[model samples]
Target: MAGVLLSAAVACVLLAGAASASSSSPRVFTVGGVERGWRQPAPGEETYNHWATKNRFHVGDFLHFRYDKNDSVLVVTRDDYKRCGADRPVLRLEGGEARFRLERSGFLYFISGSPGHCDAGQRFTLRVMAQRDNGAASPTEAPAMSPGGSFNSTPGSGSGSTRMPPRGNAGDGKTSGAAPFGAYHAVGAALGVGAALLAFAPPLPATISDPPSTAASFPAASPMASRLRLGQPNPNPGLSPSPGERKGEEGEARKPEPRREVTDLGGGSEVVHIPRFMSRETAWEMFEHLDKRIPWTRPTIRVFGRSVVQPRDTCYVADKGLTDLRYSGHQPHAHSWDDFPVLKDILKEVHEALPGSHFNSLLLNRYKGGSDYVSWHADDEPLYGPTPEIASVTFGCEREFLLRKKPTNTKSQAAGESGETARKRLKASAPQQHSFLLKHGSLLVMRGYTQRDWQHAVPKRARAASTRINLTFRRVLP
Candidate 1:
């Protein structure tokens, strides 16, 4: 009994000492405009930062929104990120301020949910100070920083003293008119001549006339130089052009109907109705041709102690042709300038038949659709350049094309004609996939804003009607 009593007494003393130490330490800290050297929270973003030092904030810490030229503040975070405990704290601006208690801890991020504000770069962070006592006071005092340190809300809003040096620089933000670092500046005369040549180079094939026959003429050359010189109306005008000659002149400018008809799908979508777009016979022929070549092999990648098989393939490359037609479970076919001969022929033929588009490169997707499918993804590869045009041709079994808009916030939905709200619009100008029966011999063109704002997929079919082959034409980086 004596030993037990003594042990209890000592334990009590240790506990008391710990409690005393915690009570004396400062637990509460404040974060706001005072800490973030800014006049307002990034013009339109909701700033973020903790009120305590380190990861120590707990329930009851107050968050404040300062007065600024702007009206209100909104906090936003991705649904997945939020569920993962990395979302920004949810707080609102009303009357003069808003507050939120730190109920939990982990990595958290946030942004202003205002009109295009977050897209403008309004972001911040907060690392709560470790808690020493549960009785820590609320965030009521102003944050402290050394002299020369201050907040600038619009610069980059948040509850931290992250500052930017005066005299705007590339590091401060994106530079507007500065030339590239280490740019090649040629000799004065040589550079001047080169610039002039580039500026005045012919915009298209020489066969094309200066002014287009329609109102949408390619604005080639200066408008003044290309203006038609019309002789004075009646002063000495000869008898009005004979009927035959008059009709000839008018017919010269009248656009010809596309030899290949286009099936107008309701809702502004249309498909090239060329007879050879695809057919059962063509699909079987392509399969036979591919079967004679080497089969595709899957490429493997190791990640986190596991081997990840990427789209892979195995092909025999010869000066003349490839001998393999198999899915390699990889993407982006290996093509080079050497392939230009055949490619040029293909482009020439297409150009002669359909004069509205031009092809620069070819991207081959070997989907030996034996047992796999590509997940939903956007092909925004930069090499394609901005507003790149693409053509997709399919050979073999028919399959469904699945396309969906990039999901976004409801409040930020884009408005379109008919005043309908759309999360995404088809490059064809409608918010739907213009599905085609991409049969053998069929070709589909994804031009205009396709890559700029939409995504596409060729999902794996449970009972694939039949094995299919797809080829996509693109303009690789020059």
Candidate 2:
């Protein structure tokens, strides 16, 4: 049944080329890794299923893959062909390299031939569009590549194995009218990422990959498993009662305790502000765990108008990792959360501490050495609503926390309310001030009125500091 579905899918895609066209260069795809066999479907083996881009592909285009037949087979087909017994032939190739002319616009998928190979980890998709490209020649040969050549090293990075067709190869050497999709990894290599494979295609099913060292304690099956994978710093230092907590300016709701708070400096204007909220001891332990477990590439982020590199050790603190608090934008890699039990426990405490608070996602930022800081910004994602609650926990190093108001206009839209009435309302955004030091094992919750009115940041200090680790829990909408 699966074989028939695949065969039909291939036919439809190959025939759909006459109508629309592509706008990018013909892409040369490659695959390699643990699943060495690339061709020849093994008994009961399933095909790979995933897309190379968010958009579809058109005709006169080619998807060339250089892979091992013994490892897996790359199949290209239409979306409707995935049914158990559907007759389809998404392009199939094995051993060495093979090219398929996707002459249609629809879904394309691939699978391995080895026994249970596809079920283990071997499938991907490419949505083929139904447009024709100006007559283009396929490349004469493939390029020299490496084992990890397909992985995108940059954050929000694209795949690297796709070779742009040579000049004059496709329409002006580019696919016109086609949207750019990020690079994709081939079958064998995709399996090599070591993530647990799903027999079917649902990603959030019952099973999940084993958490890496730093995040090892939680059950791998839970959705929160993915959230602990990321985090960031102390942007808002103080906590006050959210609107729901408070009444209309009369007898207000009880405010959060300001046990350890930091103060904002010289603030009177509205701008997105983030705070550096944590103590020194806490920062070290987090790094110690990360350094011991996951592999991290030393990277820097722009914060407080300065480009600072997060040092892997204490020495580089003087050179980078320190900056002012005015401008902050930090981007760090996702941690392999396999061992950090504290995170799971901390989250549970947060939920119980503040029942109404909610967060579905998390971003992790590591300050490997002294001087790492994240600037101010409001946590106003539309999906989380006007008054979202953000729980930021800090580990390692002690840094300053500053909170300021966002510009009235930006604040208004983000707060999801308007005018003085909005201001008077005790939502997550309001002119509230507070700051606290996040020591080792410390957790802070930012709820209500905060995202609407205030912006927080963690400015870099010239002090001889240590490393810091911060995690911000959030809920992002699809």
Candidate 3:
């Protein structure tokens, strides 16, 4: 009897403290992280499924779907999700965009309502766990809503539309979209007491990747995370390249191979493309290594007085001292070149490609598909100084590289950003002056006044399904 009373007292105190603590914020995620939004996953990209594998979802999280007006999103059960059936949908959302909030645990399914869309791989399932599974909540469950998820109405629709299904327990035969807060408090209180009663239950099943801050958190590092970080032994590291494997690679930093001159933008300004900068085998090895190990992130940036996530993932690596790089107010913390062996090898190749080149900074971009792109902009910053030479190496998928002459009358401002800022201001109104297919294992160089007179962009290719990675080597002024 005394032990029961003690546990009860502890439960009440915990419940009170939790009630006083601020509710955790719900996370909003783009359905598949595709820049083109919720549409058909291109040929090689099983977008939503691919994205789901990389992230963990919890109750109260939001999944946003962005598509054309002609397309609609259907919320369905597991059976419906499998057959691509739209006849009986839990919810049908249209008008270009929609956001759905998870209210329970288990697999939630979504599919395109258009006739042929789901058939072409437009459906995806989200495996959501209890809040505690993410190490962000107490073992007790709590009801949550997104910052503005009170409505079941389609978000981007001008006309209010609700897909609220009929409820069996409600008296009015209709249910309001908003949840009652008082009910949650009462339920939480009851759960806290029940939790105390079952004091010695087995531990919760939160993933190892979850942060170790909550009571239910796992104590060990995630196998995937550990391997990605290079902290532990991984049999198939695939990062280190063997000397014998470098059959056609240069013995040391050498001269550029025969190149195709793309264009000459005037005095000393030229863009040239070089194929086979490194052997095909070397390119493959480097791409595979960097793909799994690089700490890639698609950070949000302030653009045109508003904040938006960058379409592609990026990372920075540089030699000792260099000008700090801030891309539209977000800084990708630079990694030491010493940490990545593959980068050191690539740097040696870049040095050979452009003999006497003092390239010290590297900007890496990983495009998941055609949707991930860089807009038109020049790197005419004080950091690069004047007449900077940039060597760009490619691997994985091939993408179209475009360059256009800057408007003659336009004056140059300090456009220090990588490729996102000057996009809207320097929108390319004229046709592209040169369009080159950047092939795998190829190298491209732009020197002299190219930054002063030309702009470049990688536009979205909806049909492109191949993944691409580009390593752009630049000489950041110390």
Candidate 4:
């Protein structure tokens, strides 16, 4: 009887050791690896879907994310995940590193919280399965330890912390480890539970982008809108209310000064210039935003049979349903127009200010300094049907806009009066020339026969000049 009992105890011990060996240790996946820095999956690389599909996640396994402070990770619902809704995240993870342990046996969604990043295919769905049975493995295994040696929560531990150490490459071997059962229980319970609650149940998501522009804050019956109704110019152009003018009866606030528009060229050719069309603050904001966000390019152009780089940088942002624009022997592919909030707001203001003018595309030009310039040319492309109306908005430093009337063709004198006579007449006629100083925050509208009858250019400045950004909004017919 003593021998049998001893044998039974040994058998139990062997069985427990076998179960422990069979239980798998949790694996760690370095988000985007160390080189990629948790950004959108690169070309030819394994996408989030591809990566997720290849791995089988268990309830106890953790998904680690490592990225820059500017980027973020978001847990969202299936519907929100499909739509790439950055504004309605179920959980938001900031900081350099984050770890989310699979607590339930179901699908979990995640995406980049940055604007437009999610739409760029930076999201993934994870389906986790229940843990397998093992004799040595208990349902109550101790929580995993982070790289910093701190205890991280296990399923139902309620520690709720998402913080983790900075990302390190998996090849280093130091990031892999298995936790002993029932260890770190005291440390795990002490770590607060607020973060865990938020991780499971987040507040209503807020807008991921900046607030609306000042114009959007005004009421429908605002005095500014009433004073600057369509087709009417501000009584006093570029001048604000004086202290005396600001005072009203019984201390009531005075009406804001109206904006003015100066008609540079009238009659057959329409050219209207509105000085300070945008506020200084708004203009600076736009300038900085565009300078940083726009993907500027210096395309190559055919010059006298040899290709040469363009003098200035340019970008084409087009609306939906329009083909890419190619002009001046240069083919620049159009980038899908992203309705950037600020630019959209600015477009609304411009559309409201200009009556009967509709713009569907914008051709942006960046003049880095006095050295960058565009030679005389007319935007008389066939794509822009005859009598095309163009709205040009200027930001940054001031620059000169030169316009000259197209030379008229003289009737052949005496059938064969030596081509010199026609040339002489063309030189003598000398189409009238005009130059306007396009100040910052100004809008210039050119309509009617402007493209057909006149040529415009931003000539190189003789003296030093700061950077300038010009947006020429136009309609491109199919």
Best by lDDT: 3
The ten-residue window of minimal lDDT in model 4 covers 210-219
Steric clash count of candidate 3: 0
What pairs collide in candidate 4? 160-196
Weakest 10 consecutive residues, lDDT, candidate 1?
A: 208-217
Candidate 3: deviation at residue 50, Å?
A: 29
**Per-candidate TM-score against the hidden true structure:** 0.34, 0.31, 0.43, 0.46
| Candidate 1 TM-score versus the reference | 0.34
lDDT of 4 at 75: 80
For candidate 2, the TM-score is: 0.31
The best candidate by TM-score is 4
Candidates sorted by lDDT, descending order? 3, 4, 2, 1
TM-score of 4: 0.46
lDDT of 1 by residue, 112-132 (tens): 444443333333333222242
lDDT of 3 by residue, 188-291 (tens): 67556645654654333321111111111111234465345322333332222333334234332222344555667676789878876765534654565578
Which has the better TM-score: candidate 3, or candidate 4? 4
Which residue window of length 10 is worst by lDDT in model 2? 211-220
lDDT of each: 0.40, 0.41, 0.65, 0.62
Winner on lDDT between 3 and 4 is: 3
